[model samples]
Target: MKRIFVLLAGLCCISCLYPQAPATEAILEAFENRSRQHLLHENEAYALTSFSPAYLFDTLLPAAEARYKKHPDTWLQVHLLRLRANAASNHRNLNNNIGIRPESVTLTEEAIRLCHLEGNDLLLAETYFDMAELFNLYARHEEYITMLTKAFEIADREGHDYFPGILLYHKLAGMCKAAFHINSYRESIHYGNRALAMLGALKRPPDLHTEIFVYDLVGFSYKMLHQADSSIFYYRRINELLKGRDTSTVFYKLWSAIANGNIGENLSAQGNAIAADPLLEQWERAGIGFGDSANISLARKAQAANYFRKGEYDKALQCWLFVFEWSKKEKHFTNAAAAAEGIASVYRRKGHVDDAFFYFRQSQVYNDSLTAFNNRSGLQAVQAKVKLENLQQSLANSKALLKVEKRSKQFLLAGIVLLAVIATLLYNRQRLKAQNRLQRLAQQKREAELDARKTKEEIENFVRHIKEKNDLIDSLRDKLSSDTALKARQDILEGLSEYTLITDHEWEQFKTGFAKTYPSFFPAMAARLNQVTPAEERLATLIFLGFNNLQIANTLGIGRESVTRARYRLKQRLSLSKTEELEELIAKW
Candidate 1:
């Protein structure tokens, strides 16, 4: 009877707390109805590439901020608001530059900080999903995958809900795409299938757009893995989905062209260029009509690949040259490099040794430029991490100082109270003591600065050691390649490949050393070049260590022209004047 009464009391308390469940449900339903109205008109309200959509953020952000201030502890509410702000900012910025935007990163970091305070795992998972998007914008594939894994784990633990599942599906699909870009075929396929599984697990079927992207990612991943039949199956599935859809819509035509082009590319890859011709032509026509020069160029490249596969060297050479020129003209270094490489390979096949060497050197220059660009991006991430750490440390110091100050004030107040109750003689003595304490604190700060410089020097030495190890590995590789009689040449080559690429362990060590030595450098550099890459950062590191162009070129195993070109490209990315030296900037950093 006591247990029953206890249960009854608990139920009564719950009933008292939530007495208006029915009314609450009605209000929620009304809000959801209004939200659906907005979702339905998203194209008009939130365009993919338009500043006009920014008004939505301008209108919604103030309201969201106002509400967030009222319920500061509700992380989910604030995160959703932040997501809207980020999306709106991205929509506006992507119209001008498709690379990472400053505002998006700022908003994502804010959301991440809020996620820590959320306490609820599910809400925190959503914030992770938002962070993955920001990482994706910066082309940080590994971090993107890591954040996605966190979100997936929490969502799985919490038991899948429809809303979170929607995000998971999209994120899974995006991870597949990113993995493909980074050339991790197995991981791409894994995430692609995960997305497909997510679609199956959804209570409501995915909409056409989601289905299209999922199919495309899966199909592309399969194509890369050389699973022709499996790839063809998914591409055909996309065709089935697009069946009877309005062909007039830009998205519809775009996907249609992509799907058909992919099918042709698959056929061509299988040594049937003749069979691929019709589809390739169709895609090219559609791309040209749509004013998508990039896609048109891609179609041409595929056609060139088809010709090369068929041993039509002249035709292949013509197409490759056209692609190289087009890509170079557009400053698409990656595409240009690919084309130049292709041209060089064709020249070698035709026994034009000099031409082959020239184009090969040109390809190297472009490749090195791309490498430097990627390195710069890594430097920026390192900088951001260091900056965040410094900010946290500063915050900790401020809190500590505030606590001390508060305690001192409290003691002063207490002393005043006691003085009023007893005597006034001690008040002047307390004021003098506080002034003396302030002077000591100032001296301590100065000592701390000197200690920090010492630590910085130690970290610089460690980073220098890391660089020496890298240089040694490069020298070893060159020696091995030169020594044709080396018995374990292939084994050594495989081992070198494994070790030379930056593993997570090595990256963590580098980050730690960088953070210690260049605590303020990365943030300043990142602010100047938001889209910097890892290769550029590596170059900058060497530059900072007093390596000149020739030395950097030798260290990186690229030609001096490549080094010079990389510097030029870095200058452009940094928006520096021609007179402003990159080395000078690195020195400042």
Candidate 2:
């Protein structure tokens, strides 16, 4: 850092009275030597402060200027450009620290070219990381994300980086924080927690001030979750830690004051306004930058609780009802839940149990959602970091792949353009060749599509034709079954005809056709009819069917007792014992 030397030079002129200490001179010499050898290794990326680059340019420009004044040299001028580039890049990084973008982008690009010209991967990665921040500031999220992701890959491969606690890793995480501001709070929580966890897994915590700010952010995130109890506890712990570490830290006052006020509200809900009042007043102070109305909802909640505990239900309900209105404006889950729950409690005491039950359930559901939101938010951070890292790696691979593909496409495109130009030139002399090639390509494409279409059409046509054949068969069958002319003949045969009212003429043929279609029907009918027979002779006569008595008996498969029993069952079924005869029963049916 030539800046360090310039300041030393200024101090040296005034050191007669102050006395430049030997240790300070030794430090100056070391810095001057180190600045001379800048960008020689990757270690400088971590060890070099922002001031180092400016100091390096400050020391080198004069030397390079003095060298050129004597005689011009190519190497000297290039080296000066290189130093200037590094110095400009570091300047960009400082601008990045202060939230500037376009200037940072310009400086980062220059830095990368300088590094590339000098074959420096480590400095290039740093430059690229800075470029990512510029894009992130502009809300060019996809491109910005792509850039750091590339740097992360370079850092992993050729750039010589260790994970987590490094400045680059935090830079990657900081880029991810842009999402959080865009109401991508879920992603914000994810990336923030991932950054925290990565550092945690790094075997040692970073003592860096930037990293300490990350812890502050994490603690504040819990409060936003409306987990007041958990929020208060963590904030109390962080507040104590921050005070012990940096007593003058402004955020310590700002965030911790808010956290303390939140805890007081929680206590107030359990019915303690006296305790909460002081914390609310502290947050309401001008130095904290918090307005009185900002915490009025909390004060109202405390007042409602005090009234409720005093057994003044109407006054309590009125306070809680106002709290309910205030909570909506506040839109804070803890304050809202407390407000709703307080209203429910007042209703329960007033003996409106049903209303109390409804509000009570609403309160519980909101409270549980808040808890799950907080826990899941933290876990999501871990997952997002993995995803971010993975996405970064994927983007780098994609870039490299894109480069190869782009180059190949460019080559192919160039060839295509050249071929078209050649074809254009040849058209005057050999038009047929070009025409044939174009036609062949067109025809091939058409044939492929035609084959696909034809195959699909053939399958559809075959299915349609089969369906038509089945329809024709169904139509013919319907015509035969519904024909009325065939049913008009006496003792009509209905096999190939229609339903008929038949007579005794041609009854044998009718019976043959009827038995063919209804073979089992007759057997069941005969058994039922035999039970109704009035005499043993008729039961035997039904089985006889023009056979001898022995053959008939065998066909009936009955001893004389069953025949006699059948006759008795028949007489009972016919409601006739002595009045019924076999011949009369058969003739009647």
Candidate 3:
């Protein structure tokens, strides 16, 4: 009896060491319950503060992994992998790491694979959304959009009412707004509206903050598109929603001020100065109270516009001068350009040609600086895009090779089973074909990369040449001023300006070269061409080509001040925002 008790005790120890894995349903239910709890409180603050990385890593992840190891089920493993990735991502984000962790991406990809294998559309959609978030964290915007689009398509196909569809729409709208391009604003509005529609369709009380966010996005997009009436309508809708809310809260006050400010600006743009003034004043006061420089400047700009429209030139001049100095001090080149232009306009209307000319030149200088900055940013974006595309191509090639190897193995097995004598021959032929295909793919990738590199180098060289030519012209101007006979100096200077003037034939040649370098430039400008004069178009092209204000003046054979005036006029014709970089818009187009 004692010997039997000893054996039972030993058996009990063994059972303790190898406990049974929880059922798959129980594991899933636990995950779902925790996820729901986290997501429910997620919007209380940004940065996923509701979800604890420590808890996920220390408790949930171990539990999930243990179950996954024991069961080895596709769904179980997918959930386990997803949980691991989420934990890693959360940890990185909490640490303020701007980049994504490679492990997180790998784990997410594995989860995606398992989801596909299990034929689980909802799981696949969720995995795609997580991948999109990962790409977003890495600032791989194109990849982020691609992933989001795939998830959205999957959600639509599966007819998932809320889990991902609404979230997808909301995210896409925000992404479009962040793109900072005019066309993207239209897309933002489109997605934002759809999100609102979906929210309305829900049976339960919708998320108020989400509704407000979508409304604000839609309003801001319309404002960027210069649809002032529509923008005002949406802003008013926001105000209507905020009417009964607690005005003492920061959130309510902020949104209320934003809506009022936007409405005022739109009204002013529509030439309703009387109606805009009170709102502008209110916005200005709110800006001052909040100490928000951007809002303050915007309000002041709108006020200046109203003053100018009301024939209050002195008041307009005062406001513009203040904004100009402040913007210059703050190094806000776009605002500086707008304020300088405003000052120039006020001076011109006051019959102060010299003052107007001086301010116009100032505006032009600021504009040139803005253009240079935008060009640099655009070049960086292009380089990044090329790198991303190459990476994507490489990944595609790797996937293809994997698929080929998988198929080859399957074929080889079939051959061995059906005809053992021919198995070796089939394997040799398949191996040779795979090798040939790999070589062809490698060659294509190399050629494509070479072409991209050559194109980029050529564009850079073209820009460098333009800069060198401008430098030469500047040197000539200085030499002529210093060495010319005093009596003939004025004549020489005038003659030089005339000599530098590009003739029609020269312009045609220049345009041809430009088209070769940037084939889409003219086509992108086609819609706006009718809005500007031929001279304005030429100035814009030179600016887009990276010409400084002095270079543009020399090329056009005009006074430097005249070039500045022309730029100011061009900006007005474009109807761009006070802070919108002209070159940035052209580059995006």
Candidate 4:
């Protein structure tokens, strides 16, 4: 009887050590229930400060691990993996750092493998959505688009609605916001329209949270596009929605004030300050009462804009200057840029070119700072993607090796004496496969090299043709200078000069050819040399094509000294150091 009791106690201890399948399922279900609430409430600060997924992940980690060990290949293990990945991704999303992002990606990939194995489209869609957000936050716009596309396809094919559709809309809004930040207002409006259309197609209206977001994006996008009437239309929609609402909560009050403020700003922009002032005053009072400094600042800026439009120069200058200082001090870069631009405009109107130029440069500096942050994030995103691909390939190779081993074991068990022959056959098959792969890769490399060489030769030939034309023109000019037949020589010079002169159409054709041959060249050069003139761009292109000053002069029908002076000016325009070789820089570019 005592021995039976001991055996029963040991069994109970074992059961306690590893949670049962039912208990694991319960934990996952509870987590999913909480996830919906958390997703809704996940504002800017929620990820770092809230305790849903992060803390819950810790609490369930041991149980999940034990359960996964007991049922390594089950759906429950996939859920555990996905939950852990969510926790990791949330942690990474709180900051722009990519250090911890790869771990999250690994966990997500593991979950994805299980999802594929189990044929769970819903979970696969969700995983893709998570990864899309990860990519978007890190500035991997192309990857974000790809992931979202895949997720939407899966969800649509499987008839999964609501959350998947909402996520698609959310990412669309994010893309719009990103476009807007880069001054791509048309793209922002395009995306905003698409998102709004999608929201309208849903069988049910979106929750207030989602509706507000869409309204803000569409409204701001139109505002940025300078479509004041359209901007006011959307802002008024938000106002209509909030008209009967209780403003007891700070969230409601904040949105309410923002909507009112935007409407007033648009009205002011449309030259209706009388109508706008009341709404602006309403927003100002609400903002100050709610302690919303951003809303208050925007109202102040709008008031300054109104003053400027009303020809109250002193008040406008004072107000704009205050806003500029506040924006700089608070590190509100976008506002700082706008304020600087406004000051620059005012100074220009007041005939202060130097002050205008200085403020314009300041505005440019702030705007460039915003773009620089995006560029840094894009670099990190690319690095993270490369790391993920390497890790995933490694995992796939390991799985393939294990699968081959299992098949080999099955074959060997059929007959031990046949092992050597089977091993030789398998080795020969793998060798052939590898050889074929290598040959394909080698062929592709050769084709790419040949194509590059051919393109270079074509460009060189074109430049040489231009040089020949210039040489012919110079020879004609020499004849006109020395010939004794005055009338005939003068007529020859006129015709030859006319022949050498490039028309706008011909110049455009040449530029088109250049662009087609070297697709990335002009855009890259233009970005490096901001606001470069057409003449400077043409000179830079010629300089890039291994042209000497004399060759450039002949090609453009100018003197060699003129070409030299142009080069010097270009160096200054590009802010190149004296030690830097322009030719070498252009070559690399």
Candidate 1 C-alpha error for residue 119, in Å: 3.0
CA displacement after TM-score superposition, residue 520 of candidate 4 (Å)? 78
The better-scoring model by TM-score among 1 and 4 is 4
For model 1, the superposed segments whose C-alpha errors exceed 4 Å read 1-61, 64-118, 133-145, 180-185, 225-227, 246-254, 331-334, 349-351, 369-589
Q: Candidate 4, which ten residues in sequence have the lowest lDDT sum?
A: 1-10
TM-score of each: 0.49, 0.35, 0.54, 0.52
Which model scores highest in TM-score?
Answer: 3
* Model 3 CA deviation exceeding 4 Å by range: 1-49, 52-59, 73-98, 102-121, 135-143, 162-166, 180-183, 203-206, 247-250, 321-336, 350-589
* Two-way TM-score contest, 1 vs 3, winner: 3
Cα-based lDDT at residue 111, candidate 2: 48
Give the worst 10-residue stretch by lDDT in candidate 3: 1-10
lDDT of 2: 0.51
Give the 10-residue window scoring lowest on summed lDDT in candidate 1: 1-10
> For candidate 1, lDDT tens digit of each residue in 153-199?
77788666423345456667777877666656678788888888776
Which runs of model 2 end up more than 4 angstroms from their true locations?
1-123, 133-146, 156-166, 169-173, 198-212, 222-237, 243-255, 262-281, 286-589
Clashes of each: 19, 6, 0, 0
Cα lDDT for residue 2, candidate 2: 15
Candidates in descending TM-score order? 3, 4, 1, 2
Model 4 residue runs over 4 Å out of place are 1-24, 27-51, 88-101, 114-121, 133-146, 162-207, 247-253, 351-354, 371-589
